[model samples]
Target: MFKEQVLGLMDQAELQIEGKRKEIDRIVDRNQWKVIRAFQKHKVSDYHFAGSTGYGYNDRGREVLDLVYADIFGAETALVRPHFVSGTHTIGTALFGVLRPGDELLMITGRPYDTLHKVIGKPGDGLGSLQDFGIRYGEVALLDDGSPDYESIARCISSSTRVIGIQRSRGYSWRPSFTVAQIAEMVRFVKEIKPDVIVFVDNCYGEFTELTEPTEAGVDLMAGSLIKNPGGGLAATGGYIVGKAKYVELASYRLTAPGIGGEVGAMLGTTRSIYQGLFLAPHLVGQAVKGSVFAASVFERLGFVTHPRWDDPRTDLIQAIRFSGPEHLIAFVQGIQQAAAVDSHVVPEPWDMPGYEHPVIMAAGTFIQGGSLELSADAPIREPYIAYMQGGLTYSHCKMGVLTAIQNMIDRGLLHLEDN
Candidate 1:
């Protein structure tokens, strides 16, 4: 029944999509911009994080980052940063960028990313959560299936609330997130409560979820790693935050060393790579989604408690498989790596590392687990559920890697082979 509904929606949506597509039919007249062709040709640069390259300080690198930022977010922004470690660090900067001590913040969702629990004082990690800064933090629960609980969320907001934080994308979690309209609704709710409350979105896996961005609806600030979305899947490293000019100005100061102008003076890159990534993205993303559906369908048949979201996708890409134990976790990752490695076998073991204390074991088949189209898998050391993440810069690469991973397990009698 759900499949039928989805098919119906897609059928109807296609007509409208075509109408919209026709409006931009001239964006690729060959004479328009060379990027259109370059992207189609899959000539995007290899996404190498700046940190891997010893972090170049070239001034033009920053300019290239800014141009890419403007193109992706549709807002003239100063999206810049160098040392932003992971998603949580970027979120911390955005929260600090807008809400200071003595201010109140509504976490728009009740349970934010588990990593942020300490940052907002939920688990009593004194220095990490919101309590450390003297800022009052409020939580609103996600509905049973993980959509926004709008009314409860609205009640949490007060005049003391300076900003509302929204995680608009799916990271390594199974939560179904907010829709574009839902994000806009949160904006409307905050505006109704207090005209000045700003909305901040952790926009990973969401930049291309819709054709436009959160800014188009009413969001004030958005942040995500450069590698995940805007770096066109080729960025070596870094993250970005774009929105209202003033908020970006504040976040920029907190994000970069003094005098580095937003992304303007921080990022150096291949104009060809960023351009190509975005150009081929619409099609490449669609292909990636196709791969996810295939994974979900195949796994569900094997009876291993699959979560491919074949019928309903909460967000972009990143399919997950649930194994029951840590040993299984290691096995799952190892299987995927062996199946997809371009070279030697990549082994995964559960280990606890710095910053995040919970033991996280991972197999990084790509450059980084930030969706490098290279095969990779990671799981919490305690739980056997490993998230199999990969995206080929092109469809063929993604297809081969996924099938090989699945096949490796099946041949070993690990996964039921004929599931799909």
Candidate 2:
């Protein structure tokens, strides 16, 4: 049960965020229509939802799905498949697909998500990562304000620099997510320096948040997991890569084999959920964004720091709340788990999760394993503790989750309402 003060705080937060919620709704309206138009143009029907068999050769359903995704994202082509395991895997495929052993992959955004460190690999490690294959990696830290450091980026450019990577979301960081306008500027900036350099965006948690995606802003390639924003909470599993036909083609080769490419791979009965999920994505993403706004306002009012405060422009679903210590951080995350529709009885603890350097605590009790689109929270057990909360199939669910987390913290004396 929620304390009276907490309930009052949530009411105040909701009232304070009315205008912001309206703007999110408007964006959702635009995106929803865009999705409908794309689906209608491609004539999506029940037939397209049917499953496919071995090799999935000549799978019209799968082919049309790619067309639909390409149209929606404003890309030359798209490869939507259940084959891709996670967002990290999808992004790695796109990178490895296009980069040669001698080429350099530069990240303009400080560091990528934690899972990507291994994928970047250490030179001569022989673990078959990008560096293991002789593909060099470079990174330019964002400016103090979390904006791209153009001067640094320009200085980093070289003859071997083949790709400029931009992470649209602030993965595990306190920085603000980059907007489409910013992404467009980054694209122009990089291309101006090297006319032939490819601009790639890691678009996880950013899909459907804006009216236009990075691909439309001149990105050569972009990748995201289906269980995130674009999945609409229905897609059981998958990932998508969209961009220039050539780049997508190359990525497909890496996704499958050199010759097989996107031509094969059975649907395994995931076609319907994938299609329906895209159709519902715009509305669902709007709900999650609204929830993020509410969370920011509530936490800020409680005297804690929050990234991209309630009034800031949102480009992704992640809402970061800074806690004073590990106890407060862990309690907040476990509180979120207590609000889960599924597995609410299970308590979460910090563990050394694979692909991460620190012990990470996560509260992901959703229908789909690791589905961030369903109200979930996670944080690494380290200093300047911050919990990255994201996703909510509905705004009400997200609101309840936040309140539950607060109540949990209050019960443990980690948070006191009067401190505000």
Candidate 3:
């Protein structure tokens, strides 16, 4: 049984977040209908879920799936494939597909997720990154409030700038994620300055949270992982790129070959999961968002700092909770792991995770490995220790995870719950 204090905290949190939960449900309704309409428009059927063999040419399911995604995201076309190893690989493919040796890539958002640092690469690092290919890179850091630095962005644009990138989610950072409206404004601002520059958004962890998407907000191209919001915890593995047909085509070329773009890759047997995952995405996303709200409210009551406070507008699923130090951070993460339905016995430890600069600890007791659409929490082992908790297939599971985390902290004498 959960401690009386912990259960009392959750009970109060739920009462406090009731209105926010209603707002989430409203968004879910619109997004669910949007998805259903897309599937219906494409005449999705069991036949479309069937798998294909080698050279998977003219796979009807694959073709139709692309159409559904494009329609839902309001893009000219889309490329959704299981072949995409991760979100990083998907974004990289899109970048390399359109950027050339003389072209320059500009990031309007502050430093992107840790993984992309290597992809951007150091000049002459010999790692074959964008800089290594002689493609220039520059960035306009976000302002103190985590808003785009418009002045810096305007000054940074130049004739060589080709792709202007935005990260919709705040990866491992204590910043608010960009809303679709904010992104649309950014697109308009950039277009006003350089009408030809392509606007790209790394849309990981931000899909389906709102009624509309970045592609609909005028992004030239966008990418995300299937094991994230779009996957609905069902897609074994994959990623998606949606936007203008031309940009998507170029990305497809990078995904496959110059001539065999989006045409030859086989789905193996992931077609059904991918299709169903998209269909269920909006609802599952609502569940995750609700969990995030509860986590924020619960922790906020405990006097811990929570980004996008319980009532703040959410543009992504991540809920960042700031702890006093490493001990509190570790206990919180371990509590999340202990609450997991899978691998609950495993105690996570910080280690040098690939594609990251710092040692990271992750509580990923999920059915599909690394599936953040399920309940998970992770943090970098560094100062100002903060844990980023995201995803839950169901709100109950997410609540349990949060409560368990608090209880774990209390058990260790790292946290104390007094009468509030």
What is each predicted model's overall lDDT from 0 to 1? 0.59, 0.95, 0.95
Model 3, 1-420: lDDT tens digits are 689989999999999999999999999999999999999998999999999999999799999999999999999999999999999999999999999998999999989899999999988999999999999999999999999999999999999999999999989888999999999999999999999999999999999999899999889999999999999899999999999999999999999999889988889999999999998999999999999999999999999999989999999999999999999999999999999999999999999999999999999999999999999999999987989999999999999999999899989998878744
Rank by lDDT, highest first: 3, 2, 1
- Taking all chains together, each candidate's TM-score versus the true structure is 0.76, 0.99, 0.99
The C-alpha stretches of model 1 lying farther than 4 A from their native spots are 1-68, 81-83, 121-130, 257-283, 324-329, 342-344, 368-374, 381-390, 418-420
Model 3 residue 288 lDDT?
Answer: 98
**For every candidate structure, what is the RMSD over all alpha carbons to the true structure, in angstroms?**
7.5, 0.7, 0.8
Candidate 1 vs 2: which has more lDDT: 2
Candidate 3 least-lDDT 10 residues? 411-420
**Stretches > 4 Å off in candidate 2:** none
